[model samples]
Target: MKNPCIRVLATGGTIAGKAGSATRHDYRPGQIGIDDLLSEAESLGMAVTLSGVQIANIGSEDIGPAVWSPLHAATVAAVADPAVDGVIITHGTDTVEETALLLDLTLPTAKPVVMVGAMRPADAVGSDGLRNLANAVRVASDPGAAGRGVLVVMGDRVFAARDVRKVRTRGTDAFRGFPRESIGLVTPSALDWFGAPWRMGEAARFVWPDQWPEVPVLPIWAGIEPDYVTRLTGPDTRGVVVAGVGEGNMPEPVRQVLRELAVRGVAVVRASRIDEGLVDREPEDDANGFLAARALNPPKARILLQLMLASGVSVRAAMQAEFDRR
Candidate 1:
């Protein structure tokens, strides 16, 4: 039997690497294109019909809106083809989470969009490209994986694009579930998720935060008193995401300032410092109108807070609910 059709979109990373003296055969992005990745795919025995499509030859860390636009367009277009069963993306681990989140919000596709990256470079002695890429191909072609939304398949865990994170800086299992926890790691680079299964809602769209006020993620760490919170506010700042302690608990002192910011219409959403659990909404009587995020870590809470602020969800309850849905 013929393998399913899976398009491997090479944005370039350790997966498409060649001997680069820059980092000393240290594996770098841009040394090859989709063709090189696809060539390796065949050698790895992934028999899926592969098309080499290159989005960028640069590191995923250095990638942003300038490159994401074209890649997003390509992903949107590729999913429309009946012959294409799925799509795999080779990305840099640094910003893979951001890209995954960007695609989750911007693209409308039921077909699985798998984002794959490697910790060690391809030219290294024990590179993980072959394994990571192979894992991505399995996810991209699985009907069960489609529309679970964009996924980051690495380190033997398949994580929802929005739920995954680079927890270990230099491990093969670089990305995985956070505080919310995952259903399971079916493959080395995949994590299971539960939601409205395998369907891309047509309602998703990108309203850039450029016009919206800036939303900064002000993390409150132990003993580093938050004098910066006072100066963190911007003229156009719409809100802030406080990366607080477990269950969104902030220092007793900082809570006062955060509440004050909320009073001035600067939305403050609380996330957890713990890997598990979420920020409980302010109690009915203690309701300072601060919203709570769904186990969103500091960075992504910023993404959600910024999106809500940008889209003008004025009520704290509504903002909280919006994040829960995401």
Candidate 2:
């Protein structure tokens, strides 16, 4: 039988970064290209036949709709290809979770789509990029990796895109699954599973908007001024997500502004700034037409809100149903 073909789409991050010195922290991400990264992976002697496409070579921090639209389309095409068994994405760790979640919600194929990145630069000593790339290939080629939405592989751990978050800024083990344990782990010798497999709806059934709505995440702190909320509200603002403190609670002033925004037809979702927890609506929240983010973090909640608004669904109703499913 022919080896399964894995198409790696590279959207550069620290995994492709280059530093002046091995010990130096300053470096430019995406200095290396997709071909180079794939060569490193190939050196690992994985059984699968690997090919690559360079989607972008910019840091994940710069990622937005312009990049996401094309990336999503390319992913769909790759998964739909008969010869391709799975797909791997090389992304920057900064915003990889957001991109992964976006793909997971829109790309419904059962074929594995594994997202990988490195904490250290590619040229640095003790770089984890090559190993992570190889592990991503292994996961993508595994039949068991299918139907699990999108997965992030880093530091020998496998995280579901929806539940994964970047916890440590500089640690090699930067990514973690929150409000839930990691679904699996990847070792040189074996791939182990520990969580239930889940699937997403068909992409064809959902409409991809020509333009994405502007939804910004606002973090609430103690004694925050109402002007901060006032600045975000306008006709151009389609939705706003508040990264509130402790169970999605915001200052009363901020909450008042959110209610005003809701009255003006702007969708409001309350997500917790805390590392892990559900953000359900409190008594006051219900009266303000606010939607809880459930267990989703601020960034993920922002993505979900954009998607919901794009579909022309009642944002509150859509959000309610999404959390109800959990």
Candidate 3:
């Protein structure tokens, strides 16, 4: 390998997807090991440096701080090493976006962090994992992609980590949201675009707050119980994120609990459940409880909340300011 140290973090996802029977779409995830995946790299004609970390194999719903903590810690550590230039994470599609978003905000380094996944599991007859892996190799090895923060490479298209989202239900290109941010794209006849690289050669740049606060993102669905909110806002809670309805609307019951949380000194931010659009403030409904004027997604808003507390930024003002900085 020419580059010798492009770390490959194998937190299993569909790319490593395997099935109970080859004919079934249902997969046994976390089945493939890192070495097997790496074995394909050599065949792909890649000259990139490589390393692997097995952070988790269960469904991302099963993924939480236990898995995220070590996964994040490993990524932070990898970028600090002079021997390592970039990282490639193979994760399941379900939570890849969330993990990618989390790392986008949490990781302390700027080294390129590219995440990729497959719609079809490794066991599928025409599984897209290998090609996805190959494309990631191309992107990670590209000397131009440093300092761009984390990224997602799949279907031969590159997307910024923060902006990537999945729109398709069952296609190799199921994971959408990347090409929109593409300053350029590598097409079949135009494979030469692959050579352009995604960033400048300098390393990465990631600046985090000196302190990090613990915040919880609790969701509220119609006709749901109230215990969920109270438990999340109980003692030791620093912040609460209600995955409110459209435009930050919430069930009257849930909204009341959220207000109580705010009254108790816990920061409460309102974000919509819808994937698109800013969480609108329902003035007639009394939704001044949100921090969305700062223009943050629920998860990112929660992260900023932690960063705010860590930095001693006033909660209310921090909620508004997070949007300003973003």
Most TM-score-accurate candidate: 2
* Predictions: Cα RMSD each: 3.6, 1.6, 4.2
Q: In candidate 3, what are the lDDT values of residues 1-326, reduced to their tens digit?
A: 45647888887877776896767977777788888888877666566666787777665557766777778778888888889878888888776766776677666435667788888888787888888788777767655566555777768787666556676677887655522444334422232233343344444233445445668887767787777787666678888776766766667777677777776677777766666646644553244345662345566567656756666766565457555544
Q: Which window of ten consecutive residues has the lowest lDDT sum in model 1?
A: 180-189
What overall lDDT goes with each candidate model? 0.73, 0.86, 0.68
Clashes of 3: 11
Q: Specify the highest-lDDT model's number.
A: 2
The ten-residue window of minimal lDDT in model 3 covers 186-195
Cα lDDT, model 2, residue 183: 90
For candidate 1, write residues 61-165 as lDDT tens digits: 788668877787888778888888888888988888878887877666578888988877777767788788887887787777766778887766678876787
Candidate 3 scores a C-alpha RMSD against the true structure in Å of: 4.2
